[model samples]
Target: MVLKRIFTAIGVAAAAFALSLSAASPAAAVPVDAPTPVKSRIEAAAAPDTAAEPRTCRARFAENVNHRLRAEAGSAILGSIPAGTWVQASCTRVAGGEYSACGLSSDFWMEVYWKGNWGHGAWGCVQDWEYTS
Candidate 1:
């Protein structure tokens, strides 16, 4: 109990000090954008993808939140997935980014494609959500 109290006191003091420092900091101290190195690294990792090639991704749920693979994408969406979902792990566009699907019927589905590689996810709640039966 004493140790817990001591820790709580330390946390309160640290928070007070942090608040004071933030109040004293100049507006320009924070960078307007991400650090240059982070941007470069992201670009490098994404370099393998290109418009000329195909960007397709696919996936299958060993089991949804209900612990059942038989539960199709529609049920999966209704489960833990958020609305307006667009995860690239589940499905991909047919030709470019024109058409999309998260397996409204098919047990296995593919959502999006970037370059020659395929991505995967739960990508539910697109415009076709009504047809999910």
Candidate 2:
């Protein structure tokens, strides 16, 4: 009976020690409401700046082009713009889908705002080269 009690006491002490260690973890050392300067800086750097703003202009496609929901070429096609169609686009050319045309090769996806709505069919991205003067 004495041996069993000693073993039980050892186990209880070990468990208590483990609990104390966990409570002293680095994360636990910081106050729950402490300001995280490093995390805030990382978030600020990741946010898009005002320079990414789109420029409104008219773009005439040299050929039929697929407009995708995202800048990627493999993204879902929102609609198709026929050849020689002049579209008033609020375009922000960004690195996206790759394309080689109009005697040029690039990975810029040009934004296209179809009609008025900025979302849904007719609103998406097309190859940068598809936009002509």
Candidate 3:
């Protein structure tokens, strides 16, 4: 009977010691309403000269040409410009070398925009020589 009582006393003492240690830690004293620290990030501003000017020129497609998302021929074709369609062309020469497509050769790629049901009047690239200004 004495041995059982001694074992029960030791177990109670161990539990009390563990509880006391947890309460003494700094993390346990933090208030429940305390605000957490916040982190912020900054982004670089855009330069005025880097922005492209809104340039528009009228041109007619000599033949059907694939309107690409990028200046390169192998890029994704956003749409196709039909022959005889007058497009508002804003062209810029892509440096490297000339490219031939739609029975024309030129080093420039024109950003063609047309009015249709497509959102915001879709824009795409076509070889400069493919259309006559």
Off by over 4 Å in 3: 1-55, 91-98, 115-133
Candidate 2 residues lying further than 4 Å off, grouped into runs, are 1-55, 100-104, 115-133
Deviation of model 3 at 89, angstroms: 1.4
lDDT per residue as tens, model 3, 1-133: 9999999999999999999877767776776886522211100111246446554455455567666666665667767777777766543333323456554454445555655411111221232222223
Question: Model 1, range 9-126, lDDT digits (tens) per residue?
Answer: 9999999999987784576677687642321111122313344554443223322322112223323232232333333343232211211233332232234322333333332223
Q: Write the per-residue lDDT of candidate 2 for residues 66-120, one digit (tens) a residue.
A: 7667766567876777766766654434456655544445565456666553421
TM-score, prediction 3? 0.40
Query: Candidates' lDDT values, in order?
Result: 0.34, 0.52, 0.49
For model 2 the TM-score comes to 0.43
Error of 1 at 19 (Å): 87
- True-structure RMSD, every candidate: 17.9, 11.8, 17.2
Q: Any runs in candidate 1 off by more than 4 Å, and if so which?
A: 1-51, 54-79, 89-104, 111-125, 128-133
lDDT against true structure, model 2: 0.52
Residue 13 displacement (Å), model 3? 97
